[model samples]
Target: MPFQGRVVDIAVDEVDLGAAGVVRREYTNHPGSVIVVALDDDGNVLLLRQYRHPVGAFLWELPAGLLDIDGEDPHIAAARELAEEADVRAARWDVLVDLLPSPGGSNEATRVFLARDLTPVPEPERHTREAEEADMVAVPVPLEEAAALALAGHLHNGPTVSGILAAVIGRANSWRTLRPVTSPWEYRRN
Candidate 1:
């Protein structure tokens, strides 16, 4: 173990900014994560009403997961999370937005993907979910409705809020302006 903590670590950096002199900065080190905006044919975006024990509420969030798998690409992790949590796959994917959820306190950057061309995973191949995920309720809300809720502050999840708003913008642009799924991500771990 690299010191202590779950899913994060305390890191300190000593740097000199020219005339600013030396400074010691402390922050949380995170492996980063990915959030998926899975849109189906009916223009509905899948959301998960997952209960968070720490928060004591069933937060509405997009399908997402930690980028902790050894050697897995960001896009791959996003896909896995979508299928595991939402029971679907995307034939098309693009980068919607990248977020630094808590830059002041942590280096936990996240990549949000706009996943379209949806297809259901066969029952035999469905993920065997456990923990909070097993009790997660999948809500397929219209994209416009989800966007409105997110903008209205009804959706409290950071990634979901940012991703839904960004996805709305991406759709207006006909998805041409979005980056490829394989585009380089600063937080990507090789």
Candidate 2:
């Protein structure tokens, strides 16, 4: 490891490509993560407006979290993020999409789940927010509007845009493209 941080590690390695000969490469090793595209009955996607220090701006994004807890299922992680970030729980869950956001530079595999059958978490049971999340604002935007914003470059967060577009495609297909929540996650080493 060239450098190790709390959430990620930067690694430098030597690689051999038969045709190109040996080469050096550097990349980030991530713990993987799960994203929840929670949809209400009205077809509005739950989004959170939170400050991103790196960007120095608040961006709307789906409920998501890293799979940091050892042995925790991705499905459970998705559910936990939905509840913690959106104060809601979803009874219906399906795999919408899986992606490597930056394959060339990072091993950050993310699984986006389609969540429906929503119910609010009682106030007494809600998770207490902290840091940037403490000031996050939850907003529900219609699928079409979200897609438009994403296409317009207004929603710049990578996973948020991906999840929104995937939801749009899934909806168009009557959600037939969605896989079972327990579907195998090929990108995840765990």
Candidate 3:
């Protein structure tokens, strides 16, 4: 079935669940995505303010990009997004969180990475900013402050809020809970 309001294919499937009989699941087919919490040596996180039309206002978010490039590793995608969107490179990267953004509706899986050891790159090497990103602004917010704002209902972006909270708690736990950048991403395996 074709549902053509977006670039990706959207379809409905009838799935059997044993004694549960069959149910229809309608969802948007999506390639996975990656979010980068570019953490600076000063304990600040890179924040991007970009206009999200659906949200009706500019919202705060971390550097992130879709993992749509065929055959690109998630880590490599994250690295590219960091450089392209923020004009920075990270020497250290670790998986902060793996997400199923809307389990009931879509198979969109996202991985959030904690990026450290930042170094600025030359403008020529950056991705040409287009659309919303052309007027977007990047700001460095202290981690704790970002967490505080998130808790206070100011930071509303889902991935950004989740990433900030995870980073704060992960730090308190000595980041023992974070997985390696190369760790298996189950959803992506499909």
Candidate 4:
């Protein structure tokens, strides 16, 4: 069987699809791209609280954007978004996870990255059409606390929460491989 879909309508930001044997038309959106869940040296997760016009509410989310073009790699876009949104640059980067914001209707994919050894960079001039004049604070929360907040539904942003979870688990697994050190009392015992 071949999977086929037809575009019923096209717009600047979204498209409606009518697939074979499907009852309702599915909405496919070009959300561009995003990068989220960056960590600083102190094991703190960074987040941004910004207002979204579509939702008519201020939402806390990880830094992310749609791809400027089709051929652009998601990793590069992630790095750029991290710098732009948070004004921080990372010396090390790893892809923690890739997420589909809404699998049922939209094609929006969010790439979460674990960034370390961060250094402050000058803020880039805003190019977005939306007004972003409010102070954008880079609040650092402890990894464990952040995870708890996410679990309790206080942190509603999916990508941001997922990124933090991935980083915490990855760091724990990495630490498990290290050799244990002898205590000072052990030397006296010998």
Best by TM-score: 2
TM-score of each model, paired residue for residue: 0.92, 0.97, 0.94, 0.72
For 17-136, candidate 1 gives per-residue lDDT tens digits of 989999988888888999999988888999999988888988999999998888898899999999999999999989998888988888899999999999989999999999888987
Q: Which pairs clash in the backbone of model 3?
A: none
The C-alpha lDDT values of all candidates are 0.89, 0.93, 0.89, 0.64
lDDT measured at residue 22 in model 2 versus the true structure, 0 to 100: 95
Best candidate (score: lDDT): 2
- What digit string (tens of lDDT, one per residue) describes model 4 on residues 79-159? 777777777778876667666766576656665666778987754554333365255556788888888888988877777
Q: What is the lDDT of residue 146 in candidate 2?
A: 94
10 residues in a row with least lDDT, candidate 3: 1-10
Look at candidate 1 and give me any clashing residue pairs.
none
Better of 1 and 3 by TM-score: 3
lDDT pick, better of 2 and 3: 2
Tens-digit lDDT track for model 2 on 1-190?
9799999999898999999999999999999999989999999999899888988898889999998999998999999999999999999999999999999999899999999999999999999999999977679999999999999999998999999999999999999999997888888867
Candidate 1 achieves a global lDDT of: 0.89
- Assess candidate 1 and give its TM-score to the true structure: 0.92
lDDT for position 172 in model 2: 98
Itemize residue pairs with steric clashes in candidate 4: 32-66, 32-67, 33-65, 33-66, 33-67, 34-64, 34-65
Per-residue alpha-carbon lDDT of candidate 3 for residues 17-123, written as tens digits (9 for 90 to 100): 99999998899777878999999999999999989898799888999988878889999999999898899999999999988888788788989999999999887
Pairs with steric clashes in candidate 2: none
